[model samples]
Target chain A: MVKTDGLHFQYPGGEAFDFPNIDLSAKDHLAVLGPSGVGKTTLLHLLSGILPASSGTIFIGNTEITSLDRKALDKFRGSHIGLVFQRYHFVKSLNVEENLQLRQYFPSKLKDKERREAIAERLGLKAHLKKKVTQLSQGQQQRVSIALGLIHKPKVVFADEPTSNLDDVNCERVLGLLKEEAKLCGSSLVIITHDQRVTEHFKNQVVL
Target chain B: MKLGFIAYKNMVSKPLNMVLSLLLLVLSVSLVTFVLQLSKQLNGQMDKNISPVDMVVGAKGSPLQLVLSSVLHIDSPTGNIKLNEAEQIIKHPFVDSAIPVSYGDNYRGYRILGTDPAYFERYEAVLQQGRLYKTTFELVAGSAVALKLGLKIGGKVVSSHGLAAAGGEAHDDKPYTIVGILEPSGTVVDQLLICNLKSVWDAHDHGDGTHGDEEHREDESNLGNEEGNDHTQENERHHDQGDKEHDHTPDDDEHHHEEEHDLHDEEKEITSLLVKFKNPIGLVQLPRFINENTNMQAALPGFEIQRLMGLLGSGVKTLNGIAMAILLVSGFSIFISLLKTIRERRQELALLRTYGLGTRKLLFLVLFEGLFLAFIGFLLGWVLGRLALILVSKYIEAAYGYVLQINGPEFVELLLLGATLLIAIIAVFLASTSIFKLNISKTLGDA
Candidate 1:
């Protein structure tokens, strides 16, 4: 459950832009579509509590993130939100299994072995779980990043350009895995992407 | 904590860079260690070189030079004074005891000292062989002299005509019988030969020895009837002319006794005196009294050692200062490297930040990297410094005859090293300000 009322943000030394008010609840999948420079990623970052809003009241389960200090906000984000980046952001030195294990560094109750195996099975990453992130193919790394996003079973998953690097089939597989993991955890999914192909999987759409 | 380990792993990925940094740190630390150890060894040798004399009553000269000559055996005596003057000074009310040392002969570059039984007692020297010199020709050799010359008790060894072996003519008939060997004290005495004052007199006494001054008769007579072993190799080649020149045998017995006493009083040949007061408190007063009242000077061991430390310590401090500067520069290098690394990993860090790592945790990651490098380099340098000290100790002991204790790095050293690491880590954190200012939205958009 999340909501933002008149959320506004601006790059430092730039004019502020206000985002339209929006709301989402359990198990709802929202596709955020916008041009490259229209702050699609900014909205996702703000929703995920990774960026401060110039003027906003963002709520996740009735708690305003804008008022929290950097430390408190980080703890809040770790326990409640899972983020998937456009490019594969898996640590270069770690294997897919280790990348999944990184989720445990946050305050979470996910069992390392169980979460890794389940995510690998769902995303078809089981065959390459022990391979270093750098050693994986671009498509495989993207799958690993999506797997990492769902490993902690957060209440909400925020994806920024999640399908940009995936091919047609890999894109479908990545989106399918994200939706399946969200449904399994009773979590809502919000994806920001310039690619129009990902819109087919989500019932809800918010175009900027 | 997990992030800290991750940061450390990433920092060590460039093994060559890590090794280069460690090598620089080791080089600087080893230099500091070497200089400190050398100064320590030198100071220790200075103390050990000064032996049995409670007071260095000698002709006016630099006290340091006198100490260097008489105790260290490194220089010649100031000038010869009468033996009676030394004896009278020794019998003074405040004087506890005295040893008369006459210097002349050398065997293979080692100084040969003619001294009395008091030299042995004052130095707590033990005879390792036959006995102390019972007669004029008997000699007591130091451990090094015995070993280097291959001489043993009861063996015969000849003294060169002078201090140098190459220039001095051999005094074959005036051969010395090695009657005793001194136990090793790891001091300057280990490189000398100790004989009685009469032996020094007899070696050059033309009547007893075939080799005597033949040419420089005027110089010998200029000595004012004072008996000395100042008979050099030049005198040996020239004393033939003086073979029958001054007939001191014509002088009356009482006049000769008075002449001998005055000669002994005038030929004061002590290089330096090592004076000690009944109490350490007398240390301050005695040096002042000696410096102001007489031509001779006195020096307090502690004050002189401190002065020497100050003079020598400046060089050491300058070197340490350079080391510290390099350490600081390396700290900045580490900081810049880690900060640049974090900036390059902004998207990755932002991803982690989104996953609950805050600005503080991200900053901590960079800080941990800096600390990790410093800690490793510090440990490496400490071990390297100690190993360098051990290697240098052997060479110093052999060269200076002073046993240096190279063990025991004090707590202050460890504290200083720890502080250096702490500063390096802080520098890394400071350099990571760029990472702290990273904007997640801009980063993700760029990615």
Candidate 2:
């Protein structure tokens, strides 16, 4: 579960933000609906502990993540949180399956091939797992990003505008796949996006 | 999925940058190693060929040339010295041994050196085939000479007039017969065709080119040493008498034989003498005494070889400097490549950082790339250096008759290997400082 109370952020240049409280349990989902430049990405970054909150409490289970040091927070984020961004990223030298399995290397040195195959099969990425990500279609590449995020089985999946670059068909198909895969892994889903269509599928919502 | 594999793949991802840097690194390291090996081998060869000679007494000329020709046998002789004067120097109390050397002829560019049997003892040479030559005009061929010429024990060879392979002027009248072959000595002795001193005098100074019963009988005995039969000697003398080449025939006169014996003791000339001293005092005093008192000049090989190495050292030093400059340039190339690549792949690094790969792991990834390059550079450079020596050693053998020993990497080359890795470590660390300051939030946000 992920929870945040009185989350406030202040950049070194004095730009500040005050956020509302959020509480979500395992297998629960939330849509952070907002337009561009309204702190949607900032809230995701603060909740994930990528950027420190000025005066706030953020928890990924019983652990308050903001109080951890840089190294410990990195490890905590790796094992507990999954991040998927809109601009697709993959190690160019690696194939699709290697890119997905590489995420497990951050928190744990052991390989988890059963989870990798399960995620690939559910997302319709099973056929293209051995191919280079560059050779895949844009939709397939976005699905690979999802596999990379959840291959380690984190506590909550945080995706930033994952469906923003898709047309109507792919946009709803990707949003549906994200929620379904999060339910299969028994993890909370957080889709932070400007797309109003995502709010239709996710009943639990927050306007940042 | 290993970090090491990622590091390797990322390093080779830019083939242009990796190949450009690796080529220069390999060239510089190979050149430096080759120069060090060649210079060390040259010094080693000179020291080995010095043997036990304290001084060389030869005709007046450049001391370097005297040392090069008499001691190393790689240069032409500086004319001939009188045998009588050289024998007088050998009679001095400080002299332990003096081996008279006379050579002005070659068989296929292999020198036919005339010296006493004590010359073998100086180099510790042993017979590989047959017995030593106990008479005049019988040859004991060196291992290289026999192998190159396909010479057997009973083979006869006629020499040309000069030191090199001259076309005409062949001394076909008095051919020398191979009586023995020396084993491989790893010295200058391995390249010569050695015979008794009388062989040279007979080839060039046999008066009137005629022979009598007594002299012709002695010739048959020497020629038939391997087969000591009276019937064979009679047949050999009879066959030679019919060929009109019975030891330089001129009108078939026999009276000049006695006058030639007179010429042998008084007017016979030799090129030089390898003089070994009984004590260290002669090394300091003998060369000066022979130079001031006798008509011959004395040269100390140890001093001359040092000067020769000094002249060669300056050239090797220049090549080493150029090679070092190239190595420095290669270090900077790798540094700039890693640094520029780290900046260009900022988003990729940001993704890795966001996924909880620590700054230390990122640093190690970059360092592993450098380690891979250094390992390949040193290994290939070391092998290329030795392979080049094998090729160049052929040329060295032809020019100087000395084969440079091709051994494995010694202590100095291991130090070079150590230095190559150190350069990579320094370059990688300098390029990796930005990895610590990477902002995952800002970099991922920018994308």
Candidate 3:
């Protein structure tokens, strides 16, 4: 479960943003829709503990993430929260399987090769597992990025503009895969994006 | 799976940069190690050759040349001093022992030293085979000279007139019989051929002079003959006592007695006299006294060797400073490369932070890359240093007859390695501090 209350943030010498409260159970999904410079990414950052909120209480699973110290929040985020960025940033030096292995490593979890292969197979990336991330095409890299976000089976997964650069078909396919993976893993999904096409897919929506 | 894997991947991804940095480090480290080893061996060989003698008295010339020729045998003698003039110094009451040395001959490029039996006694050389030289033409070969010349007991060797064999006038009329061989002493004595002073004076006697010079030479020759007779009487007295105590052959005693009278007419001269005084007063006043009062020049081995070392040390110290500067520049290059890499991989690092990798792990990943390069560079440098020392050792042995042990762990090398690693670590730490202030959300949003 993921919940937030009275989330507010302000940049240094910049305008402040006030976010509405959110409540989502496991397997539910939320899409934060906003134009440019509307704090949609800031919401995702606050929700995932990537940026500290000035006055807010964020609960993921049973812990209040905003109250945790930096190290504790890092640990808590690693075990409970997963992040998928828009630009598909992978450690380009590593291969597809090693990227997933790194994600599994940070939470001090066993590198379950079977689970990794299973995730790759589910994302239709079985043939590209040994290939470097830079060698993969756009669609394949997107799928690998989705697998990385869900490899640890976190309780909450926050994605930032995951399908903004895709065509209508790829955008739908990526959104469908993300929703399906989140539902399969029983994870709450919160996606912050400016795209209008993804708004119809999620019933729980927040507009800034 | 581990952070080290990421570090390895990052290093291998840019092979050119990694190799350039490593090559610079290896060159610096190997140069320093080579200098350390060479200087250490040079100092060791020099200290081993510095005998207990206090001063060297020879004809007036360079003090360094005198010490090199008399004590180390690495240079030619200044000139010959008259034996009578040197005998005055020997008769001083404060003198404990005075060993006269004449060096005008060589066999196979090894110097033949004409000295008294006390030369072997002072160096503490024990005979390996046969007895010490008892006659003028008999010789005692050092172990290295014997091995190098393939000489054994009773082997005859003719003397060359100069120190080197090339273009040297061979004294075919005089030949020396190897009566004894000395054991290895790890000193300059190991490369010498020891005989009495009469042998050197007799071999150089050509008798070509004016009538007045001939008369003076004849008078000096008569003096030499008288000294030989006195030496022979002293030996005969000792031999008669030995023959009475133990059953010894009188035939050998007669042969030595006959050989002493042969070639007895020669003008006696010596190259130098190695001196040791009984008190500290000699160290203060003797060299001054000899330089001002006598025709001979006194050369202090310690002072002359210090001058030689000062000349050599400047070159080594300059090279060492250059090597250290190159090492520092290599460290800076490492810092720049790491900083550039961090900037280029900003988005990637942000993505790692998103995946729950902490700042400390990210810092370590970069630090480990630097340390890994240093370790590889250090290993290659160590091997190159040993290889260089081996080559230098061969050259030094061929040129100077000094053996250098090339393979050993030196304390300075370990300290250099530790200092290099510390420099690398500090460089990486300074370069990777950007990771601490990395704003993951802003970076990912910009990307």
Candidate 4:
């Protein structure tokens, strides 16, 4: 579901960094384990096409997303690649259900109400559908972020620093949900975190 | 579903800020449009007021005041013009028709105009009910006057000593009988109590009983080829000067007035002579002709009305300035508010873009917020403006005895709404230029 090779980047008037190749099949779970300042965020950015790489080939499903233009790349990223940011920020004006709908709306302007309700039910977010994400508990907000990432059934889901701030028990619960939901959607899950506790759960691991 | 939802939500998020801009916008729009529509109506009314009479021949003074008093019947007369001297202009070959209007008495603040039946023709006024006056002291009430005074046929109107309805002594002579009522034509005739020239003379004649039974032929004549009856009421007072020459009509106390014409031709007076020319050439020649040849001044009603508008123009300009200032202030407030919003909400923009909203849709979201605000402001202002017009219309009807022409959703109002929205668009665009400079990754990561 995801492949990357020769992924390198150089910032204007700044230092350069070279990234390792990555390969993952459908329903695969990969943990790119590294501490802070090890180019973990940079590698994530390069794979997502958020920053143009100096040289790289990034593929999600059958499409090479690195060559896409700004407009096309945004659409490709919205429909094929989902990112779960570290902070789990939702649109402050929209509720939990609406935020999930908005994720689907990014690629196509259509919102699937039934599919959203099913997904909310599976994620234990049915009762909190109308709640603003900020109004939810820390655990609930994290769950909402996961729901947003997998709601559109993207081919590759990136969890950036997903369990970096959690305890051992909560971290296990979050990583379990991430891997399980990714498998249900046939998406390759990549967890980028500095926490050493996350690596044991994933059979596929890469040291950044 | 529509992208405008987010825009609206974002705008209303800061309720205090949004309300400040909205209130100013509404206030300016309503105040400006209210006064403008009113002036437009007043301007229309002036044209209608002057449609009948081309020129007014009256005693020398301000020509505007003369037209206002004699033609519009809203002001006191500029003294009286001698009927004998004013006759030359009335009898001139260029004159098509003439109606001599005499004003001296009032029935409850409404003027009593003593003129011939030709006055009704000049005004295009028809009798709503009852019959025209047949003899001296017979009166006809105008529609508005009758409705207000609750006049009935055969009832009498006692002449008051002054122009005011209240605080005036009643004339000692027999009260004038209400023989007819004029239809409401939205003209000067709607606010007057009308009778023949003999009615005014008889009312002012005090206790003299000789002219009561005289025929209508005794009224002033040789009024050119046209038939017109006009007389002055300077002698209507109960003083000794009026007591001597007041009885000018023929026959008994309640005379028909036909025989008194030739005998009192020099003694008869009219407040103003309403003149219509045979051709448009009279418009140029008549005013100058009367101003130069006769003691009476010839004032064009159209010209005098424009001068009156000019007199009122300064006040309207000051009001316009105030309305414009407030509008600009509102524009500034919106500009500042929107500018601040986009500046502070860079992360919001980043989130929207990450969700699949393109650069173009981002622009739309910002612009939509402004458009919705403008739409709301204009709607509220339009309603407030129309409300003001209704209130003004009521007051004008009560004070001036005429209804203003007010309508809904005028083309000008649409243009006003369109203009307000356009300004809002420009303001929002100028404020949201920072969107182009935003780096989505940096923005999202920093926040």
Candidate 5:
């Protein structure tokens, strides 16, 4: 579970924002809807402990993420929180299987080839396991990005504009896979999006 | 799966950039290593060639030229001095030993020296075959001369008029017999043919068996007269003898001994005298005394060799500086390449941070990349240095008869390799600071 109270942030020499409180249960999903320049990515960054919240408390599971140091936050974030960005950023030199293995590597987790294959099979990436990320098509790359985010079975997964670049059909398939993967891992899902089409998919939603 | 694997992939993905940086590094490292090896070898050769002789005394001329001619045998002699005068100098109380050398002839471009057995003893030369020269017209060839001329004991060689002269006047009436061959000593002796002083006198003797003093004075004034004179008288006397008569010798010991004494008394001249002082006192007093009071010039081998090294050292130092500058520029190039790589890969680095790679691991990844390039460049540079040394060794040996040992690694090579790696690490660290200060969210959001 993730809980945020009186969340607010002020960028240096820029505007400040006072965000609404959020109460998210495990295995649930929240879509943050906003247009451009509305601090949608900033909110995700703050709740994920990537950007420190100026005046608020964020609790993921039992630990208050805002009270953690940089190093502890990094470790906590890596093991318990996952991030998926709009661009599907990956080490382009690595193949699909190796990319998943990299996520497993940093958490000091055993490289379970069976687990990797299972995740790849679920995302329909089994046939492209040995292909470099750059060789994959847009839909295949999007599924691989979801696999990367959920590989370690984090308790909370935060995605920033995950479907902005996809068409209506790819966007639905990507969102369906992300929600199914999040439910499979029993993790809370927070999707930050500017598109209104995504608002109907999540019952619990936040608007900036 | 490892960070190193990722770093390697990132480096090889842009092969052209990595190769350009590596090539510059290899060139700089090889240049420095080559200079170090060459300078060491050249200095070693110079030290080995400088014998233990304290002073070289020759007829009045340039001291350096006299030292070069008398000690190293690489220059023309400074005319001839009277043997009696040199003998007086040798008898001084402070003199330990003196060996006089007489040079005039050559056999197939190898110099023939008329000196005593002490010359062989001075060089620690051992006879590889046959016996030393005990009579006039008997010769002992050095190892290089024997090998080059295909000469053995009892072989005969006619002397030419001048040192290293081809098709010059030949002493056809009397040829010197090779009596001994010396082992290789890595000295000037290896290129010489040793004979008794009388052989040179007999070969240049132009008088008609009558007045020895007049002949000596005539030979002293015009050393070339013997070469210009017709060989009719000397040839006729040798040609009339039958083969058995030519091989015969006088049986009476007393008469042979008297003849040897008479030959010694004849007006003999030598080109130069090699002197060694009994103590340091002679070093201060002998050269000055000889220069002020005698007709000969005394050349100090140590002083002359020091001057030569001083001149060559300046050149070596300048080349070493240039090589170091090239290495510094190579370091700068690596810094720029790494900086550019970090700039281009900022988004990817941010992504890695989100995946749980700590800042320290990221820093080490970049550091290892630089070290890897340095290691490869250093190893290739070392091999290239050895190859260059092989080429230079062949040339130096062919031109100067000095061998350079280039097979082993020196201590300086290891030190240089360490220094190169250190510089590479520092360069990488300075360039990778952009990775440390990167704001992950901003970079990823911008991307």
Candidate 6:
């Protein structure tokens, strides 16, 4: 669950640009659509606790995340939330298994072996577990990022333009998998995108 | 800990750079250690020769030269002082005991000392075999001198005219028999040949009677005529017979005692004298007394050692400063490399942040990486430094005439090395701002 009241954020050392109020709840699939420089990414950062909001209160599962300090924010983010980037952000020096193992860096109560096997099985990454992230193809690397994001069965998942480079077939397939997996885990999915393909998958959408 | 491991791995990744940094570290440390050790060794040798006597009197010149020639068997005398003048000084109420020394000859760079049996006893030189020379032209060999020159007891050796080995006249006919060997003192005494003062005087007296070899050579050349050679031959024969008579003479025999006294009165000559005071008050009192009362100067061995330390230490300090500066610059290079790495890996960092890693933890990781590099570099340097010491020990000993001990690293050096690692770690922390200010949302979008 997530909620934001009058969430205002502005880039420092530049002209100020304010974002509008936002509100969302559990099992919600929210897609934020906006042009470049309209604070589409800025809004997502405020909700996720990665960037501090200029003025507002952000409640995630009834906890005031905006008021938390840096250390607490990081712990809260890693445990309760999962993020998928437009470009997969796997560490180049680490193999796929190590990158996935990093998913356990944060606090978690899940069994390590069970979580590892489940993520690998679901993402079809079992075959390339020993390969370095740099050695993987774009599609395979994306699957590894997806596996890393959902390893802990987080309550909230944030994806920003995750399928921008995928073809229509893979894009539709990835969207379907994200929606199905989020529902199974009892998590809400928030995707930020300008693509029309994102609109077709989610009935619930927010336009900025 | 995690960051330190990664930093170590990164440093080792570039093997050439790692080797180069360690090479510089080892070289600088060895240079400092070797130079400091050499100065200590040289001062120790000087201290050994100086310890037996507390004061030295000679004709007015550098006191160090007098001490060096008279005690350490290096350098030539400033000038010979009158034996009566030396005796008068030694007879002072403050005088404890004095031994006269005469030098100007060497057996292949090993000094030959001309003094009494009391001189050897005062020096506490132990005889390894045989007995002290009781007759003229007989000698006692020092351990090193005997071993190095391949001379055994009863073997004969000739003295070179000059103090050094090069370009010296050899007194071939007056070859001395090695009657005894002195036990090693780990001092300059280990490189000297001790004999009675009369033997030295007789060698000059009967062998053309000259102080220098040139004069001895001139007399021999000028006396080459039939009558002159015959007279010299007669004198040589008489000299040998006189030596035999002196050997058989009793220690307290009045006739021989009177003859020695007559020789002392005729030639008022001595190479140098060593003096010692009864109390610590002599340090302040005697230096002033010797400096003003007579032409002779008094030098404190400890003062000269400290002066030498100061001179060498400043130069060493300058070199150490330059080394520190280079180490700092290398640390900066490490910082820059890490900073750039974090910047280029923003998406990866953001991913880790989403996994509950805090900004503080991330910054610490970078710092650990830097510290790890420095730690490894220091270890490499320490090992290499000891290896270098072993390799150059013989060469250094030969050139400076001082021995270097092979041992573990000094504590001060270890502390300095640790400080360098700490500085490098701090630099890495400063350079990690790129990751500290990272925007997870923008990085995700850019991905």
Q: Please name the candidate that would achieve the greatest DockQ relative to the true structure.
A: 2
Minimal lDDT window, size 10, model 5 chain B: B226-235
Query: Can you rank all candidates by lDDT, best first?
Result: 2, 3, 5, 4, 1, 6
Better of 1 and 5 by TM-score: 5
lDDT of 4 by residue, B334-425 (tens): 78888887877778787667666777888898899888878888889878988989988889777766666668888887887877888898
Error (Å) of candidate 2 at residue B83 is 1.7
Q: How well does candidate 1 score on lDDT at residue B171?
A: 58
- What lDDT does the true structure give each of the candidates? 0.69, 0.81, 0.81, 0.78, 0.80, 0.68
| Model 3 lDDT, full chain set | 0.81
Q: TM-score, B chain, candidate 2?
A: 0.86
Candidate maximizing TM-score? 2
What is candidate 3's lDDT per residue for B1-447, written digit by digit as tens?
A: 888999899889889988888888899989999988888778777777765678899878788878988888887667667678898889887788999998767887888889988888888888999998887878999888888888999999998755666545566657899999999887777888999887875554432221133333433342233232212222243344322323333334444334444422222467889998888788888899999998789998888887899999999999999999988988888788888888888888877777777899888888899899888888898889889999988886666666677756688888998988998998899998889999988888888
Q: Return whichever of 4 and 6 wins on lDDT.
A: 4
Rank by DockQ (best first): 2, 3, 5, 4, 1, 6
Q: In model 4, where do residues sit more than 4 Å from their true spots?
A: B126-161, B170-186, B207-233, B236-263, B314-329, B394-399
| Model 3 regions more than 4 Å off | A167-173, A195-204, B84-88, B116-161, B169-186, B190-266, B377-388
Model 5 misplaced stretches (Cα beyond 4 Å): A92-99, A107-110, A113-132, A180-188, A196-203, B80-84, B101-271
Model 4 DockQ, alpha carbons vs. true complex = 0.49
lDDT at B161 for candidate 2? 55
lDDT (tens digit, per residue) of candidate 5 on A1-208: 8899999999988989888898999888999888888888889889887788889999999999999987888788878888887888988777889889988878566588888999899999999999999999988888888998899899999998888998899889889989999989888899999988898899998898
**TM-score of every candidate relative to the true structure:** 0.74, 0.89, 0.81, 0.86, 0.79, 0.70
How many angstroms is residue A147 displaced in model 1 relative to the true structure, after the best TM-score fit? 3.1
Extract clashing residue pairs from model 6. Answer: A87-B447, B54-B275, B55-B274, B55-B275, B82-B268, B83-B268, B83-B269
**Chain B TM-scores of the candidates:** 0.70, 0.86, 0.79, 0.82, 0.77, 0.71
Candidate 3 chain B minimal-lDDT segment of 10 residues: B226-235
Q: DockQ (Cα-based) per candidate?
A: 0.47, 0.70, 0.62, 0.49, 0.59, 0.43
